[model samples]
Target: MKILIVGPSWVGDMVMSQSLYKRLLELHPNVLIDVLAPAWCKPILERMPEVNQAIEMPLGHGQFSLSQRWMLGKSLRDNHYDHAYILPNSAKSALIPLFAKVPKRTGWKGEMRYGLLNDLRPNRKIFQFMVERYVALAHSKSTMLSEVTIDDIPNPALNVDNENQLACLQRFNISPDLPIVGLCPGAEFGPAKRWPEQHYAYIAKQLITEGHQVCLFGGPKDKSVTEKIVKALSEHQKSMCFDLAGETSLVDAVDLLAACHTVFSNDSGLMHVAAAVNANIVAIYGSSSPMYTPPLSQKVRVVDTDINCRPCFKRECPLGHLKCLNELMPAKVLDAYRDLNRNQNLE
Candidate 1:
């Protein structure tokens, strides 16, 4: 069967969506699976073995223009897909599949998409992990939702080659001998999601004291935040940390991250990428609850407080203290790091 999956635009959601693609491929190995995704997340879909093609969705956020929808619809119709699975909840997300007139359009019944999706799945009774929610769409009406464990999902294998890694290292003038620990300090959601910059500096300093090199990673918007993190580290510690935020492309960032022994990140895209590469990850959660969207890998260790106000799911914290993230001390994170290292050495 030829299938088209309308993937989520966010990095973490894209990573979680991989499980669904894998389950589909396992059930039907010969099926041609194409993904419609944002340009930023195309690299992620390209790395998944189940995805045959990654079609870039050009329509920007907010209300889609009628012309763009018609154009997209016509383009999808030409592909002749038997099935299209809409992953996002937005009403516009279902338009292309409906426009293409795919035989089977499946998704949860949100945004009142009665006409858009032919096979609407009820989510009221199914309270499970986000990965399971995505994968369940692949099941037939007769098929029962099997209990899925972390083992059922495969790790994200980045498509980057060794030459790409070497080139990126050379471009940055990064020494091959140094042991790198990648630090991703920015969370796009809000300030409530970000751990204190001084805390990161403290952790980086500690890592350097232990003779490990540190590399900061983030997008262009996070350049100032990354600078603050580096500046806060002690002068001796500063030499050990390289501020690569806003400097590297997504592809280059993946390559550089793949080279790290471990990655410390806020609950962001880099955290998911680090997990894809099977790097030992320390994922910090703040305002957002980990229950709904924890890193989907055993290689990751999540640190979060049991604060009542936490998991508010808001862009910014309603309370000024921001204790959900603020309470999680750097000492706790360093402890997790030590434990991860010990386990790795034994393995």
Candidate 2:
């Protein structure tokens, strides 16, 4: 069977969707899986062993012009796919699959896609995590969603090779023998999700004092924040910190992160990557609730204070205090790191 998966656009969502792709492969090992995703996420999809090829979807804004959609649909029709799984909820997300005239189109019953999806599934409330929701779609209506577990999902792996990891580290002058700690301080969501810069600096300093080198990771937009974090650290701590924010590509960031002993990050793409790599991860959640989208790895340790107004799901704190994140002291984070390190040493 040939399957075409309509992938989610967001980086983290794309990673989470891998769970569904994995389950499909497990059920039908002989099946060939192809993904339709944005150009930027091609590297991530290409890395997955289950994915045979990633078709780049050219999109501008939420809507793809009728002409563009027709062209894309034509291209997909030529592939002669047997089935298409639409991951995104938008009505437009189903256009290509419908136009391609795939034998079977599957997705949730939303966006009023009456004629688009031939096998529409009811959006059940049994699955708590978004990843689980994505995976449950693969099963028949009689399948029990409650029985789905993390074991059913495919673990995250980088498409980049080991040689690339070593080469990237060498190019960055990072020594292999020295223990590395990764810090991801940016959240594309908004300021509400961000922990204070001072707290990040404090954690960096603590890690350095404990003899670990720190690497700051984020996009070019976060360069200013990274510089401030480095400046806040004491001279001794600063010496051990490397500001590679905006310097490394997403593929390169994953490779470098794979080399780290642990990663401390807000709920972001890198955090998901760290979990996929099975790195010891300290995931800090703010406006976002852990219950809905916690890291999908056993090695992850999530920290979230039970603030009454938390998990508002807002981009910015409705109350301005941002206490859910700000109240989570640096000491607590440091303590978690120490505990993780001790546990790893015992193993």
- The global C-alpha lDDT for each of the candidates, from Candidate 1 onward, is 0.83, 0.84
**Regions of candidate 2 where Cα sits further than 4 Å from its true position:** 144-147, 150-152
Clash pairs for candidate 1: none
The per-prediction CA RMSD against the true structure, in angstroms, equals: 1.6, 1.5
The candidate that wins on TM-score is: 2
- RMSD, model 1, all Cα superposed? 1.6
lDDT of 1 by residue, 1-347 (tens): 89999989898789889878878888898899999988998887877777899999887656678778778878888889999999998778998888877889999878888888888877623635677678778886445356444456554565656788899877776776888899999987778889988889889888899898898999998999999988788888887788998998887888888889899999888888887777889999888766767776677778888888878877788878888877899999988988987988898
How well is each residue in 1-347 modelled by candidate 2, as lDDT tens digits?
Answer: 99999999877888788888878978888999999999878878877777999999899548659888878998778789999999988889998988888989988888888789988877645677788778877877577465576566666555557898999888888878999999999998898888888899988887788888899999998888899999998877777899999998888888888889899999988788877777899999999987877778877778888889988989999898999999999988888877887888898
lDDT of 2: 0.84
